[model samples]
Target: MEYKWIALSNTTIGVLMAAINGTIIIISLPAIFRGIDINPLTSFQYLLWILMGYNIVTATLLVSFGRLSDIYGRVRLYNLGFLIFTIGSILLFLTPNTGDLGAIELISFRIVQGIGGAFLFANSAAIITDAFPAKERGKALGINQIAALAGSLIGLILGGILSVYYWRYVFLVSVPVGIFGTAWSYLKLKELGLRSKGEGIDWAGNTAFGLGLILLLIGVTYGLMPYGSSQTGWTDPYVMASMISGAALLVSFVFIERKVKYPMFRLELFKNRMFAAGNIASLLRSFAYGGLMIMIVIFLQGIWLPLHGYSYSETPFWAGVYTIPLMLGFVAMGPISGWLSDKYGSRFLATLGMVIVGIGFLLLTTLPYNFNYTEFALMLFFMGLGNGMFASPNTASIMNSVPAKYRGTASGMRSTLQNAGQTASIALFFTIVILSLESSLPTALATAVTNAGAPQLVPLVHNVPVTGALFAAFLGYDPVKALLANVPSNLIPATAIHIMEQRTWFPTAIAPAFMGALRNAFYIGGIMTFIAAIASALRGKRVIAEEKEEKEVIKNA
Candidate 1:
């Protein structure tokens, strides 16, 4: 009994850290760029690696490590994750070099942190479910989900504070937490769950899956970059080739899995409709989720908050502050939804939540280019409400359905799908924004800079790459403002400086173009969430999968 609590506490801490760091880098981008002393306009790839590296590493390694946990021991592997994550944090704090190299090194270390995060996320839920009984599992999972949800937002706030004083402090904050978690988990975590052995390492399946997924993800990654005059690079020769090759490999890997004696992914799991349907729903929801966070941050930092009079420097911190509506909504309903799900089943709540989320997106679309606070806050609140309803229950359903022996792999598979979906969403959204910025950003920047009195620098302004948008976003700074700052003071009004620095100027300058891009992105987001709702609704009632006569009858044939 005590062990269950201990397990819950430790897993919660690890997951909390993992979830927080997932986004901690976003709001801290400005500080990071300044610390490293690189012009973000020229540092597009670095920005992508820094932002996407953690996600990509976690997504790629989750399933493999999950399988390893099943064979070795969840507790042993989980504790190792703590140590690795801590070490990564330390290395990040002591990052060497300067400029692009330093940025690259920091990103490299972050990838290591992501690897450790994969270990924690892949097995945390399964470990908790293993410790607790069925009745308590829903409640337990709810708490875990709450920590995850809260931790994400908390990262925004923490990053804002820590980045203000010292950019490295953001990384440093995790060190103490990681050290405690590592030692505590090592001393206290005890694995009592089913552990599979002698699977003899499915090398063929592992290699095929790893290579196939990497190729596919890389295709997705490059697809988001610019491709000569196109807003997006989906048609890039390289991206297209990668996608085609990755698909072929994945298809071949599926065949190899069936023939292998010990396949990492048991193809048979799909035979269970609930598991398959739940995963589909989970993936759909995650797609929207991954994109939504970035969009919301953009809205707040780049558009709304800034328009309302927040400077770029202060935008990151206030962005976190303003997002409290969502946080409040999630906290209020997280446990309640879990309790409701336990009593009434997950399908209704999850589907209903998706409906609410879709509606929230619709409401957001209706807001004028300039909207009032009440409307914005209310919309965000509803968005939070819908998310709160879905996240906890959906997670519980997925975990509860898996058999004990396969929990590690199943959890890993689930996390992989979710994390992968997150990565894909980011790529997709960036593609939309980057494509939009590619054309409008340069034109707008020249006029904006010229208007600010640096007509001589117009050529240089025009030369700034679209990737500048990404760097500006990561740093929580406005690209327009950065461009305008380059204007020679002698050529423009002194007020030009003040106006360019004004919160509303940048958002207003980029408003029409950003709106053009954001509208399409928001619609896509709504559609994704709506599809998830439909998937959720179709999941129907919950019935545990045990190999009973009816199940066997269905399975044997």
Candidate 2:
């Protein structure tokens, strides 16, 4: 109890490390690919594996970890988590391979990092709860949440800088922090809450949920890959089958959890209105927020930043820099919202935050795909601010609405929704963008290429797939240019061929197709954001009213 501050500090470090690593790899992916000498275009599966592998491990392990934390000492599991995460980071920095082997090693390394992240995520909240009293818990959690968000943006910027300067520095950044935090937590964080021993491990529930989530995530990840020349693979028999089976298994997992004596996922938590509503809103909010970040990254690194004179390599760093507005919004409003929720209730803040995000989304739509940089920055800043506003208060509401004993399960449940929502969002947005691009890109290119000069060869050009065109832009590659030497000298002006090779041209050429896709995706995102906000507002009001009524009854007694 005396080491509460140390507990908070240690867990914060753990959470921050995990959160940053989540997307640090994203911005640094170009360098990561290069360091290992893998071309993301031809190596598209590697890209999916690299990205999906981390999420799969974290998502798969969270519930089991949470349940174990409840039975075993949270501090014990937490210390082990730190060690695991640190080892993962060390291995990643020491990656010693190239090409396919290198890519596989990187994916394997990332999966290990995810295991570390799952440990940190699984127990950070429970530790915080143990360290802080109920009322003070929100403040502590708010600070932790803000750090996590701030770390994400920081990771973006850090990854960009480190990856640009030296690829290993990206992973190396975590080494010392992990060491210090791990040592400190082992020394300081005490096991105080939910140290129950009666409930045994729910092996069936763990296996079922983990497998189900993993299979579903893999299906979703690969589902983004073009199937037989189709832009999106919704119709891919394999993708469809994986998805159906995954869903069925997950449904069965739910049943398994209910029957199990010690369930990792406590299905009964939903009976709490505040818990249920908060989770619903959390999932939807994540659904909106998840893809938005990637879309914004693509918008900046893939398009806007490059269009505005920044190099492709420089775009990631700047993209992170530009995204600080969201962090600013979070830092500014998160504590206040948490405090206010502690007073007036979470409903208002949650609802208002959602509305703010919704407005921000609407603002995004009005700007042309190639709009004024200042206006674009302004809109993004507001959007970040809006999302920050919603996340903290909504999370606090979800946690606060449940009973003390249910807190562990409640947190896990909430996080699961969030994690799952985000994963789905990425798949959803990516699908939309790719599918839209696939439809019209070929015609546009054919006309554009022909207009530039030499008759486009029917066989050579036709043999080129639309998926290649889409991936060329998506992974920031141009498959055509990669094979430019083969083209005849008469394919028009030499300048035209040169233009095709530049980074700006790919994004600009695909702008018409990409812009529509971007707009449509944001529109959907905006609607989802607002829906989450409404749910947030509605949940807090009902929960607060019920608690007040219960308090009055106790007072009368």
Error of 2 at 339 (Å): 1.7
lDDT of each: 0.81, 0.76
Where in model 1 is the C-alpha error above 4 Å?
Answer: 436-466, 478-481, 485-503, 546-557
Q: What is the C-alpha lDDT profile of model 1 across 248-273, one tens digit per residue?
A: 88798889989988777867876666
Per-residue lDDT of model 2, residues 27-62, tens digit only: 887788878887786778898788768877887788
Q: Which stretches of candidate 2 lie over 4 Å from their true place?
A: 454-480, 483-492, 498-504, 540-557
CA error at residue 341 for candidate 1, angstroms: 1.9
Return the clash pairs for model 1, or none.
30-475, 231-435
